[model samples]
Every structure is written in structure tokens, then in C-alpha cells.
Target chain A: MRIELALFASLEPYLPEGESASGRRTRMIDLPGGITVGEVVARLGLPDQPRVCFIDGRGVREDAVLTDGVRLAIFPPVAGG
Target chain B: MGSLLRVDMACLTVKKEPVPAGWAKYAGRALTDAIIFAEVPPKADPLGPANKLVLAPGLFGGTPAPNGGRLSIGAKSPLTGGIKESNVGGQFAHSAAKAGLAAIIIEGRPADPKALYALDIDAQGNGMLNRVDDLAGLGNYETAEKLHAMKGDDKLVTVTNGPAGEMLMKAAGIAVSDPHGYPNRFAGRGGLGAVMGSKGLKAITIPLGIESLPHADKEAFTAAVRKFANALKEHPVSGQGLPTYGTNVLANIINEAGGYPTRNFSEGRFEGVEKISGETMREITLERGGNVKHGCHTGCVIQCSRYYVHPDGSYWTKGSEYESVWALGADCGIDDMDGIAELDRKCGDLGLDTIEMGNVIAVYMESGKAEFGDVQGALAALEECAKGTETGRILGDGAEATGMAFGVERIPVVKHQAMPAYDPRPIQGIGVTYATSTQGADHTAGYSITANVLGVGGTVDPLKPLGQAELSKNLQIATAMLDSFGLCIFVAFPVLDIPAAFEAIYEMATAHTGDPWDADALMKLGRETIAFERLFNESAGFTAADDRLPAWMLTEKLPPHNSVFTVTDAELDSVHDFVAETAAEMGISKP
Candidate 1:
């Protein structure tokens, strides 16, 4: 299964190896059946910090399972207006 | 009683006036708006001698009011041609209060443009107005350092502008330095810096050393303040959501709601949103030896501000919050956080409003003057503004001018000022406030987020128009009352959920003023202030016609959300009707 993952703002520098400098990471992985977002986050070596995660355009809980071709975006806390 | 400091730059003379009786009832935005309405002529050019700039501390500014150290700067706006109030947080509010000064009004331009002046208010209530020739043309970062270096910083607050204001650009803002010497704090909207620049004043620096703010009843005030602070600490929005993520948490939420204005508002969502959301900002700050969150002013427990640093631990910028990221990054289609930080730094240095300038640049990009997602072009646009070139002049003139020059149709403005990050098509409640606000398209005018949840007598969905006018009216009244107290509006989040918290603050004010009043009276006072502003604007020739969204926003249907501003013109006109009725209820007649 393949997924497009992206990080936001100050978290751009924390992307794993081979990720785009723009904080987008596109990867192919062979998952052991349906995997929860928390499990995927752990597998990717992503920090277990406070953040808002979204699948496609809608917000989802961390326990929501990820499927093939999911567009997952992870963001840190906001500092904007 | 705190003294009122009036500086007439024309003669380089400064005078101290007694704080008017009963004026303490109003603090930050409320006081500034009242002063401007009372003294400034509505028809006066915002950049001319007749206009005045008033800076007032919030009602709870110097005290332990949660998030209370907000400074409101008000003037006739060069951008909106209406009354404007831009609020910011820094050490200035505390310093101003401790120095026993209620507010400082800068009036009348100097006869010589070459001459620059700085107002210094010391701890003993003694002050001097001096010529600051050496500090001219320096950015805020440099100006703050030089001023503090000369003044010996026990607790100094410096408000200065960069080359943008020195050149009288309409987008210029007045930069107030935070406690850490970061020039991140700004009253950055509606060209207030240009107004200050027009007055021929460079900066106003106050040194903090005074003992305490004078309150009529110290015990009551302390108890009330403590009660309110505790409420804020316990409320989920104030205590947790904001402090953890700052305002950037709204990025994903707004995007999810399809209200986030992206790519110059041509779209509702940005493809590059993940790179600039609040969650990412916190993670990166932690890795780079930066603070994810810090307080804006003294005694603020809800620290929704952050210090973003370079990878090497050097300073990048302070408080790169949601608005800055949206305007400079997503709106312009640039996702690089470093690039956005640089723009934020430049705007802070130049004393310009990043939101207005970013929208202006986006308009230029839409017109083919610059390409979308062009980071270097964005930097060049800012440099042009700093240089005050012809290109810069057009850019500096703000969103409306840029839209006119570029022939772009999707210009997002209300009352001549560019709209904030929220697209009003979907968020219809906020749209009402944006259109009717005296400050012109300001999100802070009456942040309707509270009314959006509470519902107005169960008459309609907050997202619908059924009870929006009444909700908007109440919020505006509440906002005006809060602004005058010089209290930060964020305190309202907790106050909204915990009704007792507002009563406590009101009790403190009533005790201090020795006036037998309740929450209803405070609401009336807010309404009175709004009515006064409306009278001023009406006298200056503004009418129902002027209170309108841009034609594009009205005609075009925003995509993805597929929402058009469905409110009718009659609905907007009805907003003014409520103001009139409220004025009558308060025993005030429309002039």
C-alpha cells in the first residue's frame, strides 16, 4: 500500500530520510492488513507529540485505521491569528 | 488616577491631562475608540495633521488579569477610511500602567518631515519628549536595541516602525517589542503605523519601575482578578487548546470546515497546508531549541505565543501564529516555514501588517505580476515595500489598491480593509461582524465564535442568518465593553463558558469606579461606544452602502464548500437597526 504523508510548519525538518524538503513524504509500505493511524505513526518514527492529524480533508482520531492510497497529513499546534 | 499624556509633535510639546472621571470604565479598544470619535474629525486624512493616534492599555492591563496586557492602538485608517483599532501584547501595557498613565495620544504632525521624536515615560511619572535623529530609518529590531541600550532596561517597552512607516506606507504598523527583545508584537492593521509616521514620531519607549497600578479597591480587585484567572486556567479553550497550539490549531480546523482562504482565496484548501499547521510548528520548535508557546504580556497564563528559532538555535522570529502563517504562506501558496518566518520578520522590522501585505501580494500574483507559490517573488515584494519604490508604493497602499491595480475579481475586503483569514461565505456569522465592525473587516471586532456555539435564544443555527444579527450585535457590544477594560478578548473564551468569571471582572470594575452597575450596564456601554462610532462614520458620509462585502464575494460562489454569502442586503441593513435600538435602550439618541 502507498500513502502520501505531509508535515506542517516547524515540523518540516523532522521528516524521515528521502522525504521532500517541503515536508511531504510519499512512501510505499507492505502493511500487515489494516493498520491504525497510531501504529503507522509509530512505524514511521514520527514523534508522539501533541498534534492534529487528518485523513484527506477531514479530521480523524488517532485510532482510525489507514487504508491504501490514503492522504495523511500531520500538523503541529498553530501559532497563527 | 492614571494621567493622560498628550504629545503635540508640531511644537515638540508634551502635556499631562488628568484622567477623566469615570474613564476607567473603559480601558483598551473602548477608550481609544471613544477618544478618536470624540477628538478626531471623520473627514480628516488618516495620514494628515488633523488625525490623532491613541494607545491605551486594557482595563486589566497592568494587573494579574489573565491575558490582560493588551495595548490598543486606534486612529483614522489610511486603508479603511474608517475608525481602526489594532491590539497587540508586550511589556508596554504593564509599563504604561505602572507609570500611572492611562493612555498616550499623539496629535498634529511636525512642521519638518526630517525631524523625528521619541516619547520617554519614566517610572516616577516624569517623562521627556526628545528628538531621536539617530534612530531614523532603522528597523524595529535595531531601534528597540538602540532605545533599550540608551534607556537601561529595567523593564522597558519600545514601540517603533521600520522604513515602511518612515516612508508613510499605508501598510505600515507600529511594532512593540516583547520582553525578550523580539520585535514580534505589533498593532498591525489598518495602517496605524502610517498614522504614527504621519505624526512625525518615530517611537514611544516606556521604562518600567513604578510600584503598582492605582485601584479604587485593591482587595476587591485582587479577589476578582484571581477568580477570573482561575476560570481561565480551568476552561478548556483558554487553559488547554490555545496554550498548547497557539492560534495555529485553527489551521486544520478551518481547513476542515472549508473556510480557510487558500491561494489568494481562489480555493478553500491549500495542498501544502501540512507544512504550516500549528502542530508542525510546535514539533519543529521543540527540535530547534525553540519555545512552542510563550505568553504575550505580563501575568498571562495562556501562553499561545512561541519563539521559532533557526536550526542552529539563533532567533528566527517570535510568535509566528496562525494569521501570519495563513497570510504569508497558504494565501500566497508558499509552504516553506523558513520563508514565511523571514517575511514575518521583515514585516515586524518594517512595522507592516503581514495580513494586509500578504493579501496585497496575492492580488498582485493573481494579476500575473508575480507567480503563485513564488517564494522569492514574495520576498522581493516585501523588499519593494521597505524601499518605498513605485511598485512598493502600490503594494504598501494595501489590498483594495492592489485589487484595483490588478483587475482581480476575487478581492476579499469589507469596508475597504482586507478580510482576515476566514472566508465569510461559509462562516456567515463572522461575515456579519466583519461588515458591520467600525474597524472595517476585522476578525477581532466581534469574534462571534461564542455566539456561534451558544445560539441566540435558540432562534437559528449559529451558522445560519436567522439570529445572526442579534448575536453579532450582542458580541459587538460585549467586545466593545471588554476592549475598553483593556482586557484581552481571549479572556472572553473562558468567560463565555463560565458566566461567573465575567461577573467577577465586572465586580472589580464597579468596585473601582464606585459605580453601582451590573453586567447589563457594561453591555450598554459597549453598545454606546459602537453607536458613537457609527455616528462619527455617518457624519463622515458613510451609509448603508459603505457597509458591504466586496462585489466578488457577493457574486461568486466559493468552491468545495459551495457556499455564497446568502445574507441579503436587508439583513445587513438590519444590523444597523439593532444598534439604533440598543442605543435607545441605553438612553442615547443617534446624532
Candidate 2:
């Protein structure tokens, strides 16, 4: 089972070296079956304080269950006028 | 107290006066609105002699407050026919504050038709207005270059208008200096630029100074400033996200939320959003040798501004921020990033408000004056605007003018000004602000985007009208207070979420004034200002009927969520009722 991890804004730096920091998708990562959203973030070692991860465009908590082929996107807090 | 300069353009006279006793504590919008309410007749033609232009810096300016250098330009708006207080981030306000000057008031039009005046604060520390005959009809960039060259110093801070203003175009904005001496920051709304142009004054310059204005409690102010800085640094939005991707970061987030306002607001999202998202902009900026970590003024920790460069590596413009990007790119059906940046540069050169200018261009496209997705045609229209051609002059005024000229009935405007980056139908909170703002569809006037979209203060559903009235009212009052202190509105993010963050602001503001101040005092100040503005608008003929979304917003349901501006007319009227109640609490009598 594989869950595609996408990063946006400052959170993109935590992705693998070949992964792009902005719009273009660099590569997809394969995660173990039955992985929780929290487990994926912990594996990436991204900062815990400033991240909002979305699954299929809906925001999910750390305890949210991940399914195969789910497109997960993460971003840091961004507020502007 | 800081001094005020009264520049009487009609007689070509300049006077220095002590700050009025009653206005001693006011700054920014609060200060400007007070002066306008007292001196300007509500019925005065905005481009006529009776109208006056007031420019003021925020209270924390010349201090250590991060992003505290915002300047507020206020007048009777030629576009909205209502009071306007437009804010800009730049070095002009900061420099004026350092020189112990709080505000500059330009009153009366020139006696001579073509007499162009330039106000200069000399190295000897004396300020004077001079007639510069050669500077007539120059672009903003050319004007900045000529002024800097004539001054022969890198310390010149200038606020000037460009050809759009000279043409008396309603969308004109005053350009202020960035840290690098570029004229990029703008008080960019409500046709205030046309007021400046009518005066026949081109630029006002404040010489750079080293001395800091003394605070009543220096030690306490310093400590409080430190606390506030710490608060900003710790916030992920201010400290990291903005510095990393700039304000354009919202392109992706808003698009993802299905509230991006594309193609004359016919749709809620853009298909080509990824091409112009902040993430893509950042990568492109780096590839093109641009500086993404720049601020509009000094001491801005949340460097949400960026300077873009051409593909050939030469500088283009300082920014095409989220709103400008949306107005030009998605709103017009053009998704080209470079073309959008070029349009931003053109607007800056013309000293036009990009948001308003884009709205007009989009309306023109809707009327078949130009084709959708025609970046070159849009650029050509801007060129004609600068040239002041017949068609150019009509479109230059604003969206309403373009709509009328083209005989297009589906014009999206409130109180004669164009709707900004957000479509109020999907983002109902902002829509409430648009229909009801004193300044006419200004997003920053009462930004409910925090609650509706970003979840900064509290969660309010973007799709539903539930609890939106209260949310907009609270934000408008708080935002009014923040503008008075000269603190960047971005600080409200942390101040909203963290008690200590707000306490730091409260402490810093109160400590500097050496007065006993609290949340109630601040709220009172905001409420009174609102009452005063409302009175001015009322005298200018604004009614509850004027505070309404365009008819299309009610009948035309937005996509994705299929939401109209569900916030009813009664609910929208409630926002002002709260202001009136607060005004009554503060002993402010409505006119």
C-alpha cells in the first residue's frame, strides 16, 4: 500500500532531495499499509508546531487513518491579506 | 507629540502646526478620518478644491514595532463618493515619524492649472514646497529617479502619483518608497490618487533622519516592543510562512478551498491555479534571480513582499501579491505569471491601483472590448491608460466606468468601487465586509478572511452565513484599533490566537503614550472612529440601501458549494448597529 505525500510552502523542504519545493510534483513516496497520518509526519521529521495536512483536499488530524492511494498534502501556517 | 504639515496647494503655501490637542492620541486611519470629518464637506467633489488629502503614519512608527511603518492616506473617495482610508507599507511614513512629523494634509487645488509642486524636507531639517516645472507628466519610476537624482542622496523618501493621477483617473494610488528607494508601496484604493492629482502636486519628500522620537516611557516601550517581536517571531505565519513564500502563498490555499474568484468571479476556483501559486512563484523567482525575502519597510519580520525579476534577470516589480495576482491572473482568465507581473509593473508605473485596474480590464473583457486570456490586450489597455487616450481614460477610472462605457449590465461593484480578490458569494464573511464597509468593498477595512478561511481567530464557516455578522463586526473594530497603533494587521493573527501576544501590543501602545490604556480604551477609540466615518458617509448620502451586495450576488449562486451571499440584508445591517452601539458607549453622537 502506498500513500502519496505532497508538501507545500515551507514544509516542502522536508521532502526527499529530488522532490520539488513548489508546484511541480517531483516524486511519490510509498508508505507501509495501515499507516496513520501521524506516523507519516513522524517519519518525515517535519516540525510538529506548524503544519496542516490534508487528505484528498480535506484537513485531517494526526490521528486520521490513511488509506492506500490517498493524496496527502501538507503546508505550514500562511496568513496574508 | 509629532507635528503636522498643512500644505495649502491653492495658495502654494506651507505651514507647520502643532498636533491638535483633541487628536493627540490618534494615528493612521483614526487620525486621517478625524481631520477629514472636521474639514472636508461630505458633498465636496472629490477632485475639487474643497476636498483635502491627509497622510499619516501609524502610532508605532519610528519605534521598534515590526512592520509599523504603514501610512494611511485618507480623503473623500472619487470612486465610492464616500470616505476612504487606504493604507500602504513603505519608508515614507517611517522617515516622517523619525522626523517627528505625524501627518501631512494637502488642502485646496492649485490656483494655476499646470502648476506642479514638490514638497521637500531639506538636509538642514527645514521642509518647503517648490515648483518643479520639468516634472510634469512623468511616470512614477521616472519621477522617483529624477527626484533622487536631483536630491543627490540615497536618504530621500517620497510619496508621489504617476500619470494615472495626473489624468485624474479614479483608480490612481499614491506610491511610497521601499527600503531600496523603489516606489512600490501604495495607498491603493478608492480613487484617492485622483484627489492628489487634482492638487497639481507631484511628490512630497521627507529627508532621512537618525534621531528617534522620544517615548514617554522609553524603557517600558522598549521592553514591550521586544515582547511583541518575540510574539511575531514565534508565530508560524509571520516568522516562517510569509518570509518563505510571500503573500502569494494564498494562491494555492484559496484555490484549494474553492474560493479563488476566477474569470470575473464566474467561478470559485481556477484550473490553472498551480501555474501561478505562491509555491510556483517562489521556484520561478529563485530561477529568475529575484529576491523573495524582501519587506516593504524597515523592521518587518513578516517579509511577505517579494521583488520579481524578468527571465533575463533584470528587475520587474516588487510584488504581484495574492490579491493583485487574483485580480489580474484568475479574475481576468489569464494564468500567465510573468504577464501578471508585467501588468503589476505597469500599474505601479502609472500609479494605478492594480486591484481596481484589473477589475476594469476584466469588465472590458467581459464586454468584448478585449478577449479573455488576452494578456497582451490587457497590457495594451494599460498602455492606453497611461497615454490618457479616450478609451484609456474611461477604463482608468474604474470598473463601474468601464461597465457603463461598454453598456455591460453585469458589472460587479459596490458603492461604485470594484470588488476585490474575493467573491463574496462563496466567502460570505468578506462579502458582508464588502457590502457594508465605509470605504466601499475594501477587504482590509474589515477582514473576516481570518475566521472564514485561515482559521486565525476562530473558525467560521466560509460557505454559511451563520455567525458572520458578528465576526465581521468584531474584526472591523479590532482592525480599526490596530490601524491606529500603526501595527501591521498581520500581527492580529498571533494577537488573535494568543492572549500574551495581544497583551504585548496593549502594553507597548499604552506604555509609549504614558497613559493608562486597556482593551476597553482601544475598543472605544475604534468605535468612535467608526461612528465618525459612518456620519461622514451618511452626510454623503449613503443609506442602508448602499450597504448591499450587487443584485447578482444574491441571484447568482457560486459553484462548488453553490452558495449565494446567504448573509441577508438584515444581517449585514447588524454590523453597523454594533458600531453604533459601541459609539453610544463611547459618548459619540451620530450625525
DockQ, 0 to 1 scale, candidate 2: 0.48
lDDT of 2 at B30: 92
List DockQ for all candidates: 0.19, 0.48
lDDT (0-100) at residue B428 of candidate 1? 74
| lDDT scores in order | 0.76, 0.84
Q: Given candidate 2, what's the lDDT at residue B94?
A: 75
Stretches of model 1 off by over 4 angstroms after superposition: A1-80, B21-24, B450-463, B581-591
Specify the poorest-scoring 10-residue window by lDDT in model 1 chain B.
Answer: B453-462
Candidate 2 C-alpha lDDT tens digits along B426-470:
788998988888988888978887877776787787778999899
Please, what is the TM-score per model?
Answer: 0.88, 0.94
